[model samples]
Target chain A: MRNLKMTIQYDGGRYKGWQKQKEGESTIQWKIENVLKRMTGEEIQVIGCGRTDAGVHAENYIANFHTNSELSVETMMDYLYEFLPEDIVVKSIKDTTERFHARYNAKGKTYVYRINNGEVRNVFNRKYTYHTSVKLNLDAMREGAKYLVGTHDFQSFTSQKPKTKSTERHIKYININKTGDMIEIEVDGNGFLWNMVRIIVGTLLEVGMGHMKPSDVGRILEEKKRSESGPIAQAKGLCLKEVHY
Target chain B: MRNLKMTIQYDGGRYKGWQKQKEGESTIQWKIENVLKRMTGEEIQVIGCGRTDAGVHAENYIANFHTNSELSVETMMDYLYEFLPEDIVVKSIKDTTERFHARYNAKGKTYVYRINNGEVRNVFNRKYTYHTSVKLNLDAMREGAKYLVGTHDFQSFTSQKPKTKSTERHIKYININKTGDMIEIEVDGNGFLWNMVRIIVGTLLEVGMGHMKPSDVGRILEEKKRSESGPIAQAKGLCLKEVHY
Candidate 1:
């Protein structure tokens, strides 16, 4: 048996998400597994580093799978590239140790959300950015992002109540930058809860739009109530930029 | 009647082309005319600055139409924005003189062609760039581009025989630039013949790939035979960047 580690990139616009489903819906994982099954002539299951919500893109997603196929890594990479859909690409493939686990071995993750704050939308980039003509207060958004950094329980930022043993997670950094008419929010963390990044972006946007105050994030986090946070930002603007091991 | 001048942007991946077709094919002009007809209750003919081939995009295409409607420019802009498809956008709209014509009054035009010279294609920008894995010689391409500048009869560069009174056209400049793994060729000229820009790109790419020498471009231009030039590049990589008046 050989363990294969792969770096993947996908445009998740047409996919349900990264995970396989019982309904057999189209997903990035399902697509790759289907290709692998055909190539290896065996049922193949791929474990991803983490799950991304529907319509979220990824530039450097990591995954690993165990297979008994005798094909070389170069041959497998070439075959996968030839068979996979244009939106999903296997960037690199390599043989790894049997002990390697994609999810458990992941030490950190980074996500970036894009907002097109221009009066006129960019037609070419419409799929990847969320459009908003409303003027955003960059300074206020930056101030609000600071509160979300450091280790804390991000219970209020997720959709459901925490099922894990603890909701405590360390957010290493939060950077807000405006380039031309596009504003990008980049967040790095050890782990993220369901919809946590999107919800945090929503809360920061609310503060930028003057609907909420920067200090409100602290109170919301302390309360640990989902209703206290801002509405969940659209999934289309969010992209899993990197998975660091 | 007021002559309205508008700047348009579109992702032409799905459209047939910029010109309206008699066979009821979907075109950018047809879509805009349909919206104008419904809004003004009159047969509206929109004349664009030039025709773009199928799958070719535009960033600052100019167009003009005479409308009898009493709607303000702001209202028309809003209506167009609401009615047009997500891939098309009206960047700006203003009133122009009666003597103005979209095709005839244009002084110069700028076009840009992008090449993804990377090992892996960028899925997010797949529709907008042409991918080639071959390492390109930028200095060679730039050397070839210099020969195409200034006044020249570029009959060999165009696919169709010149129907105009003169085949002479002046190329103002050609700028070849590389940003990361993307190569951009920006050309500015008084006017372009059909398929002229694509053919020029094809020829330059040949030089970049070391198939042709840089000085061969001058000889190809002097021959004035279309067969002497390289094949026309794909339309997806070409975009009308600006229309200068």
Candidate 2:
């Protein structure tokens, strides 16, 4: 058996997400597995680096699977490219060590949230961004972001009921960039709980709108309560940018 | 009564073009007229500078209409912005002289066609660009464009069967720019016949692919027949960039 790793990019507008569900429901993993099973005549199970919610796009998602087929990586990639739908593309494929696992071996991840601050919505980019007519204070958002860029208990930033041994995670960096009427918030972290990124973005947006102060983020983190944070941002504006290993 | 000129932008993926057609079919002009009629309780007819084919987008389309509504220009613009569909946007509106007709008094127009030369199709921008795997010769295409940038009978470049006495037109400029995997062809002309811009783009594409030489454009123009030119490019790749008065 040989282990193969692949990088993927997908527009998740009409997909149920990156994980397989029921037989009839469509998902990114189910689509790939169905194609591979037909091509190789084997029940192949593919594992992704992480799970993404519905309507969340991905630019550089990673996955790996084991197969007994003798075909070259390039040939397999071509077959996958031809069989996959137009919304999902396999960027690259390569052979990997037999012991490598996609989910377990991941070291970190990065995500980006986009906000369209233009008064008039952009017809072309409406699907990829959250449109807001209200003007946002970038300085206030930057100040709020600074308080959350270290190891801390992020229970307040996630809706997931804490059942794990630790709810603490290290946020490596948070960068806010503005180009024209578009605002992008890029977050890099060691790991994240469910809905953590969306919650953090929502809280920061409140600060930008002057509803919350920069110092309020420190208190929200210390409180370790989900209700104390701002509402979760919409899923359509969140994208999984990269998975680091 | 006042004559109002409006600059509009739209994503034409779901529209039938820029003119009113049958009762059920949707068009840009029809959408605007419907809103105006409801707002003023008067029959509204919008005259566009030119008609765009089905699935052709517009970044800056010009149109004018006469109305007796007493509302200020800004208030009328706000009402249109609030009521128009998300795909169509009114960029700017202002009062213009009664003699300034949208179609009859136009000085010139500009159109842009986009081609994606990347190996992998961009999922995000698929609707806005036409994708091709073949490598294009930009220099050869530029050479061909030079022949078309002057006054000539463009009957061969248009699919329309002209009834007008003269088919001569002045092409001020044709700019071919290549950036990364994107090729943009921008054309400025005194006027254009039906399907003229698309056919011109198709002929230039053939020149880029080495099927037609740069020198063949002069002969094609002399022929003055539609069959002498290449096929018309797809409508989705063409956009009305601006109208110069």
Candidate 3:
């Protein structure tokens, strides 16, 4: 048995995120599995660090899986890049310890959400950015994000989905950076719940746009209710920046 | 007659190019025309500075059209932005002199082509860049480009499809800048022939890769033959940077 560590990147626009689903429904994992099965003539399970929502994207996402086939890690990546859709890219593959797991043993994760704060919509970048067309107070959003740092109950931020039994998580850090026409929110955390980042973003956007007080984020966290937070932002602006282990 | 001056931008990945074409299917002009017709209930003819090829992007393009409608420039641009597909944007519009022409009155046009010179493909930016994993000899390419600046007969770089009466054109500036994993080629020309920029990129790429000598570009120009130049670069990497009139 060989442990293969793959650094994957994908445009999740046409995918049902990263999880495997029905044959007709598209997924990043299903596409990878299909391509690997075709290349090695053996069924291979491609595990991802975490699942992204549909229309979300990734730049450098890490995933690992075990295989008994003779295909070398480098060869597998080369073949996968050639066969996969242009939107998906397998950047690198390497041999790892047999005990390596993409998710269970992860230490920290980082994500970046882009907000287009420009008055005009960027036609080419519409698919990847959240168009606000509003003048945002970045300092207020940054101040609010500081309250989200450190380990705490993120129940107000996470969705009450059936799959998630618990809402507690630790967000190590959240940094908001502003460029000319865009604002980038970078969050580092030990773990995140369903829609946690988007909710945080939505909440922060409200604070930035003066809809909510900057200190209201602390109250939302303490309330431990999903309805207390602002609306969840669109998934398209969210990106799985990195997975760490 | 009200002359409307419009500033436009588009991601040319899906269309057949800027010019109105009947054989190769839909073009950007046709789509804009359809939207304009829908808005004003009248046929409007728009003239652009130059025809950008299929898959070539534009950040700022100029166009002019005559209309008898009472729509304000801001209202027209707003409506166009909403009406046009997510890939195209009408950034600004203004009423201009009746003598204004997008093509004939143009003083200079700037074009940019991006080459992603990296071992790994960027998944998020796949559609906007050309991936060339090989290292390039920047000095050699720059040397070749120096000869391209100034007035010259660009017949060798022009494609021979529908014969144009003249192929000679003046290029005002040629800038080759390489940053990290991308190389940006910027050219300002009085006017470019069909496929001229793409072919020049191909020739410069060959020079950078040591496939063709840097001095060979001068010979190709002197030969005045399309076959003498390198293969035309893919249209996806090229963009109309700006049109100045």
Candidate 4:
């Protein structure tokens, strides 16, 4: 068997999510698999770095799979890109060991959430940005972001939905960059739970808008209860930047 | 009567163009008129700076209308923006003297055309940019652009379907900027005929692709025949930058 690693970038606007679902439901995995099947005439299973919710975008996502097709890596990548829809693009492909799992072997991940804090609607960025007509205090947001750095029990930030693994995860760094009418929050973490980044963004927005104090974030993190966290932000503003091994 | 001069921006992806047509066919003027009528419950007419073809975009188009409604500029703008869809935005509103006209009073107009000279399709910019997988020669394009900047008849560059009274238009300036896979051509002209910008772009592309020599543009311009021009570029790549008076 030949193991392959693929780096992907997708708009994710028309996709149900990254995983395959029941028949009649369109998904990113299903689209990729369908394209691969057309090219190789064989079933190919693709394992992505992680699952992104509907409407979420990705700049560079990693995936791995095993196949025995005779097509070279370059030929397979070019063929797949040509066959796939315009919304999804295969950036690069390479050979990898069979034991490297895109998810489990990932050493770090970076996610960036964009908030359009402007009075005018950015028509050019309407799909990729979440519009917040309400004005925000950028200084207060950066101060709140400082409290979110470092490893901690992030149960309050995660959703109450069940998962197969532990909820505790390590957040290595957090940076809040605010310029003009756009605010981008970059989070580097070992792993993120379901809705963790969205919840963190929601909490920071509350602080920025003066609805809650910066110290409120520490209290919520200590509560270890999902209800104590702020509201979840929209999925459209989130982008999976990179998954590193 | 109160004269109003307004700056407009639109996606232009949904309308039939700038002018009103049959009932089923939507146009930019029709949408603006409907918004104004809904706000004041009075029928009004709006005159635009220029007519853009269907699927073209604009950032700072100008328009004017007369209204007896006693609505403040801020209030009127708020109602229109709130009522209109997200794709259209009214940047600002001003009360102008009756002598001001959006079309005749305009001094110059600037247009920008975006060409995505890349192998991959950018999903976010799919609707706004023209994708070309073929490589272009920048030196040849620049040489051709140099020949296009001058006052001329422009009859050869225009189409027979415009049916305008005159085809004598002057091009004041032309600039080309290319960065990696994106090439933008900015044009400043006294006036433009129907599909004039699209035709210019098409002819320039032919020169850049080595299909025609740079000197061929001079001959094409002097020929004053529509058949002498290159194929018309698609409407998606053109954008009305601004109308200055």
Q: Candidate 4 chain A — worst ten consecutive residues by lDDT sum?
A: A160-169
lDDT of 4 by residue, B30-109 (tens): 88888998777778889998788998989898999988989999999899889878888887889999988899989889
Top candidate when judged by lDDT against the true structure: 1
Candidate 3: how large is its RMSD?
A: 1.8
Error of 1 at B68 (Å): 2.2
Candidate 2 achieves a global lDDT of 0.90
Give me the runs in candidate 2 sitting further than 4 Å from their true place: B162-165
Which CAPRI level is candidate 3? medium
TM for candidate 4 is: 0.95
Instruction: Put the candidates in DockQ order, highest first.
Output: 1, 3, 2, 4
Model 1, A1-245: lDDT tens per residue?
89999999999999999996666899999999999999999888899999999999999999999999999988888888889989998989999999999999999999999999999889999999999999999998898888889999898999867665577889999999999999999999999988999999999999999999999988899998889999999999999999988
TM-score for each predicted model, relative to the true structure: 0.97, 0.95, 0.96, 0.95
Q: Summarize candidate 1's per-residue lDDT along B164-192 as a digit string, tens digits.
A: 54678899999998899999999999999
lDDT of each: 0.93, 0.90, 0.87, 0.86
Q: What is the Cα-based lDDT of residue B27 in candidate 4?
A: 82
Give per-model CA RMSD.
1.5, 1.8, 1.8, 1.8
Candidate 3 clashes between residue pairs 3 or more apart in a chain or in different chains: none
Top-DockQ structure, candidate number: 1
- State the interface C-alpha RMSD of candidate 2: 1.1
Interface RMSD of each: 0.7, 1.1, 1.2, 1.3
